[model samples]
Target: MSAQDYAEISTLMQAYADGLYHADSKALRQVFHPRLAYVCATPGDELHLDLETYTARIDKRTPPSETGDARDDRVLEIKLATPQLAHVTASMALMGRTYLDLLTLQRTPEGWRIVTKVFSYVPMEKS
Candidate 1:
Protein backbone atom coordinates (compact mmCIF):
# COMPACT_ATOMS: atom_id res chain seq x y z
CA MET A 1 0.00 0.00 0.00
CA SER A 2 1.19 3.45 -0.80
CA ALA A 3 1.51 5.99 1.99
CA GLN A 4 -1.63 7.54 0.58
CA ASP A 5 -3.51 4.28 0.97
CA TYR A 6 -2.50 4.06 4.59
CA ALA A 7 -3.42 7.68 5.10
CA GLU A 8 -6.87 7.22 3.64
CA ILE A 9 -7.49 4.14 5.72
CA SER A 10 -6.32 5.94 8.81
CA THR A 11 -8.65 8.83 8.12
CA LEU A 12 -11.62 6.52 7.69
CA MET A 13 -10.80 4.74 10.92
CA GLN A 14 -10.65 8.04 12.75
CA ALA A 15 -13.94 9.00 11.23
CA TYR A 16 -15.46 5.82 12.58
CA ALA A 17 -14.14 6.59 16.03
CA ASP A 18 -15.48 10.11 15.93
CA GLY A 19 -18.77 8.88 14.58
CA LEU A 20 -19.08 6.44 17.44
CA TYR A 21 -18.71 9.23 19.98
CA HIS A 22 -21.06 11.41 18.01
CA ALA A 23 -23.56 8.62 17.28
CA ASP A 24 -23.43 9.32 13.56
CA SER A 25 -24.29 6.01 11.96
CA LYS A 26 -23.86 7.42 8.51
CA ALA A 27 -20.27 8.28 9.16
CA LEU A 28 -19.69 5.05 11.07
CA ARG A 29 -20.81 2.99 8.09
CA GLN A 30 -18.54 4.66 5.58
CA VAL A 31 -15.47 2.66 6.53
CA PHE A 32 -17.09 -0.69 7.14
CA HIS A 33 -17.85 -3.32 4.55
CA PRO A 34 -21.45 -4.30 4.08
CA ARG A 35 -20.76 -7.69 5.57
CA LEU A 36 -18.45 -6.46 8.30
CA ALA A 37 -18.03 -8.61 11.39
CA TYR A 38 -16.97 -7.31 14.79
CA VAL A 39 -15.76 -9.50 17.62
CA CYS A 40 -15.37 -8.26 21.18
CA ALA A 41 -13.30 -9.69 24.02
CA THR A 42 -14.67 -9.01 27.46
CA PRO A 43 -13.25 -10.07 30.82
CA GLY A 44 -14.88 -13.44 30.30
CA ASP A 45 -14.46 -14.14 26.56
CA GLU A 46 -14.69 -12.98 22.96
CA LEU A 47 -17.92 -11.88 21.35
CA HIS A 48 -18.69 -11.75 17.61
CA LEU A 49 -21.14 -10.00 15.35
CA ASP A 50 -21.87 -8.73 11.87
CA LEU A 51 -22.40 -5.17 10.71
CA GLU A 52 -25.91 -4.86 12.09
CA THR A 53 -24.72 -5.75 15.55
CA TYR A 54 -21.80 -3.38 15.35
CA THR A 55 -24.05 -0.52 14.35
CA ALA A 56 -26.15 -1.02 17.45
CA ARG A 57 -23.20 -0.08 19.68
CA ILE A 58 -22.48 3.25 17.98
CA ASP A 59 -24.18 6.28 19.41
CA LYS A 60 -25.20 9.31 17.37
CA ARG A 61 -23.75 11.28 20.25
CA THR A 62 -22.46 10.63 23.72
CA PRO A 63 -25.17 10.86 26.31
CA PRO A 64 -25.13 13.95 28.53
CA SER A 65 -24.46 11.72 31.54
CA GLU A 66 -20.93 11.07 30.34
CA THR A 67 -18.62 13.28 32.44
CA GLY A 68 -15.14 12.28 31.32
CA ASP A 69 -12.98 13.74 28.52
CA ALA A 70 -15.44 13.02 25.73
CA ARG A 71 -15.37 9.21 26.24
CA ASP A 72 -13.74 8.53 22.85
CA ASP A 73 -10.07 8.06 22.26
CA ARG A 74 -9.33 5.63 19.44
CA VAL A 75 -5.81 4.96 18.25
CA LEU A 76 -4.97 2.86 15.22
CA GLU A 77 -1.89 0.79 14.40
CA ILE A 78 -1.79 -0.41 10.82
CA LYS A 79 0.36 -3.14 9.27
CA LEU A 80 0.20 -3.93 5.61
CA ALA A 81 -0.19 -7.58 4.71
CA THR A 82 -0.32 -6.94 0.99
CA PRO A 83 -1.32 -4.30 -1.50
CA GLN A 84 -4.96 -5.15 -0.92
CA LEU A 85 -4.96 -6.37 2.65
CA ALA A 86 -4.00 -4.84 5.97
CA HIS A 87 -4.18 -5.64 9.64
CA VAL A 88 -5.32 -2.73 11.76
CA THR A 89 -5.86 -2.58 15.46
CA ALA A 90 -7.38 0.20 17.46
CA SER A 91 -6.55 0.94 21.07
CA MET A 92 -9.35 2.94 22.52
CA ALA A 93 -9.72 4.92 25.72
CA LEU A 94 -13.14 5.85 26.91
CA MET A 95 -13.46 7.81 30.13
CA GLY A 96 -9.62 7.43 30.19
CA ARG A 97 -9.18 3.63 30.08
CA THR A 98 -7.47 1.54 27.46
CA TYR A 99 -9.19 -1.21 25.48
CA LEU A 100 -8.49 -3.02 22.21
CA ASP A 101 -10.24 -3.09 18.88
CA LEU A 102 -8.58 -5.32 16.24
CA LEU A 103 -9.59 -5.14 12.65
CA THR A 104 -8.86 -6.77 9.31
CA LEU A 105 -9.38 -4.77 6.14
CA GLN A 106 -9.35 -5.23 2.41
CA ARG A 107 -9.46 -2.83 -0.51
CA THR A 108 -12.85 -2.95 -2.12
CA PRO A 109 -14.60 -1.43 -5.10
CA GLU A 110 -15.36 1.60 -3.00
CA GLY A 111 -12.07 1.77 -1.09
CA TRP A 112 -10.48 0.25 1.98
CA ARG A 113 -13.13 -0.92 4.42
CA ILE A 114 -12.98 -2.87 7.63
CA VAL A 115 -14.20 -6.41 7.17
CA THR A 116 -13.67 -7.56 10.74
CA LYS A 117 -13.17 -5.93 14.13
CA VAL A 118 -12.30 -7.53 17.45
CA PHE A 119 -12.71 -5.67 20.73
CA SER A 120 -11.18 -6.22 24.16
CA TYR A 121 -11.26 -4.25 27.39
CA VAL A 122 -8.64 -3.92 30.11
CA PRO A 123 -8.44 -2.59 33.66
CA MET A 124 -9.15 1.08 34.11
CA GLU A 125 -5.91 1.65 35.99
CA LYS A 126 -2.83 -0.37 36.82
CA SER A 127 -1.40 -1.01 40.25
Candidate 2:
Protein backbone atom coordinates (compact mmCIF):
# COMPACT_ATOMS: atom_id res chain seq x y z
CA MET A 1 0.00 0.00 0.00
CA SER A 2 1.11 3.54 -0.58
CA ALA A 3 1.78 6.17 2.06
CA GLN A 4 -1.59 7.77 1.26
CA ASP A 5 -3.38 4.49 1.92
CA TYR A 6 -1.59 4.06 5.22
CA ALA A 7 -2.36 7.60 6.27
CA GLU A 8 -6.04 7.26 5.39
CA ILE A 9 -6.35 4.06 7.37
CA SER A 10 -4.59 5.66 10.32
CA THR A 11 -7.11 8.46 10.26
CA LEU A 12 -9.96 5.97 10.29
CA MET A 13 -8.52 4.17 13.28
CA GLN A 14 -8.14 7.40 15.18
CA ALA A 15 -11.73 8.34 14.43
CA TYR A 16 -12.88 4.97 15.71
CA ALA A 17 -11.03 5.43 19.00
CA ASP A 18 -12.30 8.94 19.39
CA GLY A 19 -15.86 7.93 18.57
CA LEU A 20 -15.91 5.37 21.34
CA TYR A 21 -14.18 7.73 23.71
CA HIS A 22 -16.85 10.38 23.23
CA ALA A 23 -19.78 8.09 22.34
CA ASP A 24 -20.22 9.99 19.13
CA SER A 25 -22.39 8.02 16.73
CA LYS A 26 -21.78 10.51 13.97
CA ALA A 27 -18.06 9.89 14.02
CA LEU A 28 -18.62 6.14 14.03
CA ARG A 29 -20.87 6.38 11.02
CA GLN A 30 -18.26 8.29 9.11
CA VAL A 31 -15.69 5.51 9.41
CA PHE A 32 -17.76 2.32 9.54
CA HIS A 33 -19.27 0.60 6.56
CA PRO A 34 -23.04 0.28 6.47
CA ARG A 35 -22.73 -3.51 6.65
CA LEU A 36 -20.33 -3.67 9.57
CA ALA A 37 -20.25 -6.72 11.81
CA TYR A 38 -19.06 -6.25 15.36
CA VAL A 39 -18.22 -9.31 17.40
CA CYS A 40 -16.64 -10.04 20.76
CA ALA A 41 -15.98 -13.49 22.17
CA THR A 42 -14.40 -13.45 25.60
CA PRO A 43 -15.03 -16.67 27.48
CA GLY A 44 -18.28 -16.19 29.39
CA ASP A 45 -18.99 -12.92 27.69
CA GLU A 46 -19.78 -12.80 23.99
CA LEU A 47 -21.39 -10.06 21.96
CA HIS A 48 -22.44 -9.61 18.35
CA LEU A 49 -23.76 -6.38 16.96
CA ASP A 50 -24.42 -4.90 13.56
CA LEU A 51 -23.28 -1.42 12.77
CA GLU A 52 -26.57 0.25 13.65
CA THR A 53 -26.99 -1.62 16.91
CA TYR A 54 -23.43 -0.97 17.95
CA THR A 55 -23.75 2.73 17.27
CA ALA A 56 -26.99 2.89 19.22
CA ARG A 57 -25.41 1.25 22.25
CA ILE A 58 -22.50 3.66 22.07
CA ASP A 59 -24.88 6.59 21.91
CA LYS A 60 -26.44 5.51 25.21
CA ARG A 61 -23.19 5.18 27.09
CA THR A 62 -21.80 7.76 29.50
CA PRO A 63 -18.66 8.82 27.64
CA PRO A 64 -15.33 8.56 29.37
CA SER A 65 -14.64 12.09 28.21
CA GLU A 66 -17.30 13.41 30.55
CA THR A 67 -16.15 11.17 33.39
CA GLY A 68 -12.63 12.60 33.19
CA ASP A 69 -11.17 9.15 32.68
CA ALA A 70 -7.59 8.88 31.54
CA ARG A 71 -7.53 8.21 27.81
CA ASP A 72 -5.60 5.12 26.79
CA ASP A 73 -6.36 4.59 23.13
CA ARG A 74 -3.60 3.35 20.94
CA VAL A 75 -3.38 2.03 17.41
CA LEU A 76 -1.23 -1.03 17.88
CA GLU A 77 -0.76 -1.95 14.23
CA ILE A 78 -1.98 -1.38 10.71
CA LYS A 79 -1.29 -3.88 7.97
CA LEU A 80 -2.30 -3.57 4.36
CA ALA A 81 -2.57 -6.86 2.52
CA THR A 82 -3.68 -5.19 -0.70
CA PRO A 83 -4.32 -1.74 -1.95
CA GLN A 84 -7.98 -2.12 -1.10
CA LEU A 85 -7.75 -4.20 2.05
CA ALA A 86 -6.23 -3.44 5.44
CA HIS A 87 -6.26 -4.75 8.99
CA VAL A 88 -5.88 -2.71 12.14
CA THR A 89 -5.38 -3.62 15.76
CA ALA A 90 -6.00 -1.15 18.55
CA SER A 91 -5.94 -1.02 22.32
CA MET A 92 -8.28 1.22 24.23
CA ALA A 93 -9.62 1.69 27.75
CA LEU A 94 -13.25 2.28 28.47
CA MET A 95 -15.55 1.71 31.40
CA GLY A 96 -13.41 -0.46 33.66
CA ARG A 97 -11.82 -2.62 31.03
CA THR A 98 -9.06 -2.64 28.44
CA TYR A 99 -10.14 -3.54 24.94
CA LEU A 100 -8.09 -5.06 22.15
CA ASP A 101 -9.70 -4.76 18.75
CA LEU A 102 -8.97 -6.29 15.37
CA LEU A 103 -10.58 -4.31 12.64
CA THR A 104 -10.91 -4.96 8.90
CA LEU A 105 -11.06 -2.04 6.55
CA GLN A 106 -11.67 -1.81 2.82
CA ARG A 107 -11.06 0.95 0.40
CA THR A 108 -14.35 1.87 -1.19
CA PRO A 109 -15.59 4.31 -3.77
CA GLU A 110 -16.45 6.72 -1.01
CA GLY A 111 -13.32 6.20 1.10
CA TRP A 112 -11.77 3.78 3.54
CA ARG A 113 -14.35 2.15 5.80
CA ILE A 114 -14.26 -0.38 8.55
CA VAL A 115 -16.12 -3.44 7.32
CA THR A 116 -15.74 -5.63 10.37
CA LYS A 117 -14.59 -5.32 13.96
CA VAL A 118 -13.84 -8.15 16.39
CA PHE A 119 -12.62 -7.41 19.87
CA SER A 120 -11.91 -8.78 23.36
CA TYR A 121 -11.59 -6.95 26.65
CA VAL A 122 -10.40 -7.69 30.17
CA PRO A 123 -11.13 -5.91 33.42
CA MET A 124 -8.47 -3.44 34.47
CA GLU A 125 -6.82 -4.07 37.79
CA LYS A 126 -7.27 -1.25 40.26
CA SER A 127 -4.17 0.49 41.59
Q: State which candidate has the highest lDDT.
A: 2
> Against the hidden reference, what TM-scores do the models get?
0.80, 0.96
Q: How far off is residue 117 in model 1, in Å?
A: 0.3
Q: Find the 10 residues in a row with the least total lDDT in model 2.
A: 40-49
Q: Write the per-residue lDDT of candidate 1 for residues 22-59, one digit (tens) a residue.
A: 66667768989999987777868677788876677664
lDDT of 1 at 69: 51
TM-score of 2: 0.96
> Going through the candidates in order, what is the number of backbone clashes in each?
5, 0
lDDT of 2 at 81: 88
Off by over 4 Å in 1: 59-68, 71-76, 95-97
Evaluate residue 17 in candidate 1 and report its C-alpha lDDT on the 0 to 100 scale. Answer: 75
Q: Mind giving the per-residue lDDT tens digits that candidate 2 earns over 1-127?
A: 6889888988888888888889899999999999999999777889889988998898899999999988899998899988889999999987889999999998899899999899899999999
